[model samples]
Target: MSKVVLITGGSSGIGKSIGEFLTQKGFIVYGTSRNPENYPDSQFSLLPLDVKDVKTIEKTVSTIIEKEGKIDVVINNAGAGITGPIEETPEAEIKANFETNFYGPINVIKTVLPQMRIQNSGLIINITSIAGYMGLPYRAIYSASKGALELVTEAFRMELKGFNINMTNVAPGDFATNIAAGRYHVPLNEVSPYLKPYGNTLDLMNAHVDSGSDPNMMAKAIFKIMNTKNPKVHYKVGAFMQKFSIVLKRILPDTVYEKLLMNHYKL
Candidate 1:
């Protein structure tokens, strides 16, 4: 039987690419967006979903299950980004980022776990980031959010092992996406010292994102993990150095790894 797959935050970017790719590969793909009216119709089903809303998530999943029978794979691709100094970030902004990036995935995972456990087989893929492995300068909240999700994914993989459910945290480095347009900015006051430095840092980050390789690369990695009988716990998708950075973090000392990152960002 074809796999029934559900992907969140599929309005555009890597999530959308993954959905389109999976559809071509014959998976029964259902991708979610906050507004289904704007979702581009395709072989993949576009359903209304806002990861932050538990009811919407529950309803969307149930709707899919009622039609597709079972969800074989759940991809937590929905995310939010924030750019600014941690100190200047508003409480509401921080909460919003966590709600969408971290808690959102948890909501999806918990909602699907029972059904997956009963099926005795399923895959849960979370779209983390290279930033998750290490905290970045301006994108403090975004990095923290992804890092939290990655840790959660790791813990759940072990806990769900007995049920034959697998988890893969795909830590993508950079890809051309509209994330910058949606990223929240921490309001700065006239006396704020982080103003200029924050602007410079954000510019550098945007340049890096613009230069990022195609999102399709990440999509291919997702497909690989989905098809593999025994997939690894973590997968990094990006340029050579980006993937290497993860390895470097594991082997290099904290100070050394951080210095390397700082130098790369010209900080």
Candidate 2:
């Protein structure tokens, strides 16, 4: 029997790529977007779901279960990107980022756990970020939001272990996607102290995404994880340095690591 898979934020970018790949592999793939109508040519089903809205999430999950009878895999791929200096970033924007990146995934997981538990087996993959491993300048909120989800996944794995519902985080580095266009960027202020560094960092971030690896790479990585009988709690897919940065953080002294990051970002 083909396993049914649900991918949030499936309309485009990594989610769409993953959905298309899994569909090609014979999985019953369903992807979610706030506006499903926009994608008329998607390879798999595109359902309406807003991760920030629990009501919409509940509805989407209910619709999926009704149609498929069981959901074997769920990829929490829906997340928002926010870029701004912490001090200059509005309080509302920070909270909004968390609502979509952290609380959103948690709610989706919460809604699906009961169905998964009843089925006796399931897999939940949270799409995190390489940035989540460390605080990135001007993107502190985005880092915090994804980092919080990473930690939550750690706890969730242990909590759900006995029930056979495997949960893990897949942290990706820069991927060529429309994420740069979708991000909420705090406007560069003329007189703010962070204007120079923040603007430069934003440009660099955008350039990285423009030259980043294909999203299909993420698709292949996710497909592999799904096939594994026992997936590890954390898997990272990205450029060598991006993945290695995590290692560097672990081994380097606090100030040294900070300096490295500051130097790289030219702060």
Candidate 3:
């Protein structure tokens, strides 16, 4: 039987491209979207799912299990981006960020773990971000959310080792995706100190993505991760600068890393 793969946020961008690429590679790929119709033409199956809603998550996974009988791999790729200064961001927005980027993936993981455990063999690939390691300036909440998931991924990997279930984090750098168009931004008026810099930095970041690496590279990286006998805890997928920055963040002092970030993002 072909390996059954489930990916979140498969309607467009990285998620969608990965699903398509995997299907071409002969995997039975199923993808998720809040609006299934929006991705009706995708090569892979598009299922409706809202990561924040337990019922929707369970139903989607159940539907896949019923049809495929087994889920060999799951890519927790469903997430959104939010941008703003820490102070200006509302409590609700921060919670929403965690809801989509953090808790959302957890919901799916919990739902699938039971089955993966029963099978005694499976892979859980988390599409994390470079920001998860080094928090970005304006995208504070987004970084925090991904960082939290990275911790969970680490702990879960240790706990699930005995079950033959593999867990890994695939941190993709800025890829040329439609995420920039859909990213959420906090409303900053004249009173906000961050209003001016926010616009300039966000635009620059968007352009960086526009000129960033190909989403196909991300898909290829994930393909390698999926087939590895025992994948490592974390893998960085992106350009030289992004990968180097992640490496530098690990070895560099906090002050030095912060300075690098400030200069790179023009903060």
Among these predicted structures, which one has the highest TM-score? Answer: 2
The TM-scores of all predictions, comma-separated, are: 0.95, 0.99, 0.97
Backbone-clash count (model 1): 0
Indicate which candidate wins on lDDT. Answer: 2
Stronger candidate by lDDT (1 vs 2): 2
Query: Where is model 2 more than 4 Å wrong at Cα?
Result: none
Provide the lDDT at 263 for model 1.
83
Give the candidates in order of TM-score, highest first: 2, 3, 1
Per-residue alpha-carbon lDDT of model 2 for 1-267, expressed as tens digits? 999999999999999999999999999999999999999999999999999899999998999899889999999999999998898888999999999999999999999999999999999999999999999999899999999999999999999989999999999999999999999999999999998999999999999999999999999999999999999989999899999999999999989999999999999
Collision pairs in model 1:
none
Quality of model 2 by C-alpha lDDT:
0.95
Q: Candidate 1: lDDT over CA atoms?
A: 0.89
Per-residue lDDT over 81-192 for candidate 1, one digit per residue giving the tens place of the 0 to 100 score: 8888888888899999999999999999999998898789999999999999888888889999999998988898899989999998999988888887888877655688
lDDT of 1 at 261: 75
